[model samples]
Target chain A: MSYRKAYLAAPLAALLPVQAAAQGIDETINTIFADYTGWYVSLIFADLPGTNFSWIALWLVVAALVFTFYFGAIQLRGFTHSIALVKGDYSDPDDAGEVSHFQALATALSGTVGLGNIAGVAVAVGIGGPGATFWMIVAGLFGMATKFTECTLGVKYRNEYPDGRVSGGPMYYMTKGFSERGLPGGKIFAILFCIFTILGALGGGNMFQANQAHAQLSGVLGEYPGWITGLLLAGVTFIVIVGGIKSIAQVTEKVVPFMGIFYVIVSVIILLMNFDMIGWAFGQIFMGAFTGLGVLGGFTGALIQGFRRAAFSNEAGIGSAAIAHSAVRTKEPVTEGYVALLEPFIDTVVICTMTALVIVITGVLNIDPETGLYVWNSEAGRISTEGEVAGVELTSAAYARAFSWFPAMLAIAVVLFAFSTMISWSYYGLKAWTYLLGEGAAKETTFKVIFCLFIIIGASANLGPVIDFSDAMLFSMAVVNVIALYFLMPIVKRELESYVSRLRSGEIKRFKS
Target chain B: MSSEVFVVAYEGAQDDPGVLGYAMQRAAVEGATLLLVHVLEWSPYSFLTPEELEERHGRRAKEIERARSDVTGPALDKVKAAGIEAECVIRYGNVVELVVEEAGKAGAGMIFVGRSGSQSVAARVFGSVPMGLAQISPVPLVIVP
Candidate 1:
């Protein structure tokens, strides 16, 4: 039977699942998820009729490019001011209650900078060869303008409560922005966005993070029950989310930055150790971008992998960062937009590029001396690696070649990254939950409990279909949010123009030199 | 009354009270107002959790209120009871810099600060508040142990 038909018959088929019991509960759950949700996953990820390029990736890339041209490349023009804003050079002391531009950017970074940097980049480079890094950086640069537009609208249209709380995101902008323009379907779009956000939160945000954490732990500590890692992670998350324990969040917040710095330092050390190879790595990346370096589908394959990973990694048009940046304490909405643009630059341009460089410089991928092309393994369907590893493991192997202790440290970092990502996504999901269900303790707690439970399920099972479905839900958010951005770009443009003129006239005073 | 003011670098109730007493005596002797400055150490570049970000505004307001009512307010009352005119300034930033800036703005003849009792290596190696003020304070600095 078809997967769609399987989903419909799941309830009745639930009685017939005893056959897979000998394979363990994880296997059984995986089978069920594959059977029931496979159709939805296939639909969301379905490529163009003749091409391997995902329409969702194209949707995001096109929107980013559109924003780039429309804003006069604000990401480049306003780059200096964005740095100044983040440095608190223009911040007014009176605006003390709002989150500082730096804090907002850091918080948003913690959310997007997790597994995507470590694992996702490896996947792109592994399949697309070095050339994928070029497209990834390009996508990241264009995505900055998209972040500028959405975050500007996010702050402008945010809902400020009497008690100093804020609620914003694609949902708010879609509803308020659409209605303000006298457009129909504002509320409908908002509701749809929230639904997608909630699903995306539970699946990609919570479950996928939990699964990866479990994988990392098992990879290092030896195989144990996945539920043990899940329970531990869930219990810790539950305390933070339900009990309002700030200590874990505080610790993670502090460590995540140090972890990022440490990761960069190690990568730099490895790069320096292979200092002479830097130029060669760049050559591989550039040549691979245009010629695919002997990868499958050649040029198109490299471009697709690079763009897909970057779009997934940085989440420029996904509208999640908008929610986080919306809380910045600034009277000038455009200022936050300037600051938000840095998110993609830091996430994709810097961190992801670092990963790709390390992979290439370490000589992890085999290259045939005759053709000077990456030795693609037909059986594995990707470039052959030094350790026959993939994803984060490949990254670990590359670094471990330099430092034997690197993998253990990476394991800890992976857990921390996953935990922090989960916390940030929980907030995003909670905001969407409150928006849809009308905000009460009981309703909010209901969502939080379910979220924590999904952590257990995610860690315990190899639910590929579930992850794919949630990933689709996450990308689907960009679809609805980007459509509204097209309508709302004029508002952002007006705000930007007014702010710039005032700034030029010295009507907006600088608080710091 | 003289136009001169003495800027007292108040840390908190946990700080040594000798700075406030010394500043008050000098202010009374010179017939100048005591400018008690309290700074809550804050950096905009610091990392914050999502919950903290959401409640930062409320927490900041509450922090200002608590500093006013619990720390600076009582110091002002003590100065007023001593028959010395006094006011207070509370802000959030680097302590040494803000205190020095407040002294400059108040055009104080002298700045008073308590000796930092921190024996931590970071304090000794990096310099303490008193050390910082000693290096940068435009006016005369009084370190009351």
Candidate 2:
């Protein structure tokens, strides 16, 4: 991702001195990126032969399935226990005013629940049809196990400093867990993970969010230049991270989660309003999953898009949630695992499903009356829809069907989601940067400066391949993270077994009703 | 055990020493014991990051230490000098509820609380602990100026 961006950015940087002489900067940048990274993008997002499933998406789904079985379907068995943990039922009240399982989950959800559910889901249904929703739900269910496994290990092998700050993620776990198992290459694996994490944080977390947010703002507020938005985001980020305006930061943290709840509530309202079509929408999703109906790629198209979107949406196997969940104040690490598993369920199974149902029930997808399938818009390579729309716009249009003002609401949601994701990623990236450079005032400040710079570029520059490359970096993180998980999952199993047994015996006391 | 007991709703703010002084004198005169109750204003619904969550144990430990060193410990010494038996409690929750509960548990004859002096609009709008305790106190309430 970094290489591709620099390769594309160098000439653009040179053109800065002569922008009037060399016009069409946006088109030029897009063309250069598309040409240079086409092969790499294909390799990253390549389909598996006759099937539509990308290998990266397959890797995530397979890992989720493996964990579901390996942990004896911990997601399902521990679901209620996870809810209890989030609710602080078993938490000691003496330790109140700290991060609860719910807070960690909320923070992590803010990271994943951004544009993926809004824009990414629309892209899926546009191509894969409503049947893709079924696959997305399935993938999400399995993904819960992956979250449980990673977060259990996250808390178990975290670094607790003298100052009471804790740091945990694939980097900590890969190094610590691997070393605990007498492995020699833990440090190298950890270093690789950190590198990927930083890059992923910059591209997907920072730049992509800014870019998408700009796109949304422009969609609503007219064809305003992107830098204005970029400057605004950069300024806010600078104030919070650099200026040390904690009150504003606190308001932001609160805003992100409240917006998330608000989005879900609105989706619920739309669903209830379309009450009669709910069951019929499910029928379409189920039938489309197998038959593909008017959708392209038959059953495989729907499954691939669903799996891809779910992987992107909830981010279970990516190991980012582990960082957030690791801070949970529980003696039993398994409690955090239970709490973490709820993330995928909420992000994918609930939020994404709500978005999909609203899209389907509203009859946004163009359907062939004869075939009773989603009308295939082969040029767009997904299911055809009214106006041939895709991405966040399609989701906006669908919601607008229920309420005319919804697109405007969605635009606000898009910007908020994008901004919140950027902020969370800033933290994630900062941690990775610190891990690589060693924690210090200077190193941290330097990383923050670069992060701010990228937010600007992401908002202003139309570098399609660069963002795509960053997304590749994100998927690459899952690759390294899951490899480390394979080595470390046994330890998680041991923790889960012990916690579950003790709970069954009433050893873990519940202090709250 | 003393026949009479007095509870001081001590937040240990600027006027807390005055409140404690008033309560200590009253207790000594009536041959009553003292309960120096300090509530470390906290809510379960407050937002906390993961780092804050991990440090909750240490933070709670510090809250208790601070309560002892800053408020209850000094007040306890003052009461001892006055020849009145006194105990301390540092708890977490609503100030009014915790203060009243501690007073009731100790079987106190009266509760002493500090006034906010100005009775500013901000305090009235947001609601003050002293006002809350006055409304809810089970026993006779004394507002220390």
By DockQ, the best candidate is 1
- The parts of candidate 2 lying over 4 Å away from their true place are A1-23, A35-38, A461-467, B1-6, B14-18, B49-74, B100-111, B115-145
Error of 2 at B99 (Å): 3.5
> Which digits, one per residue and each the tens of the lDDT, describe model 1 over residues A165-274?
76668888898999989999988888888888887888778877787777766666655556667889999999999988889999999899889889988988888999
- Please report, as a value between 0 and 1, the fraction of native contacts recovered by candidate 1: 0.60
If chain B of candidate 1 is superposed on the true chain B, what is its TM-score? 0.95
Model 2 steric clash pairs:
A99-B53, A126-A383, A127-A382, A294-A373
lDDT of 2 by residue, B1-145 (tens): 5568888888775655688888877887898888888888876566654345556657777778888998778878878887889888888878899889888888888998888675789877877877888788999999888
- Model 2 over residues A107-147: C-alpha lDDT tens digits? 78878898889887887788788889999999999999999
Per-model TM-score on C-alpha atoms: 0.93, 0.89
Q: Which candidate achieves the best lDDT against the true structure?
A: 1
After superposing all C-alphas onto the true structure, candidate 2 shows an RMSD in angstroms of 5.7
- Individual DockQ of the candidates? 0.60, 0.44
Model 2 TM-score on a 0 to 1 scale: 0.89
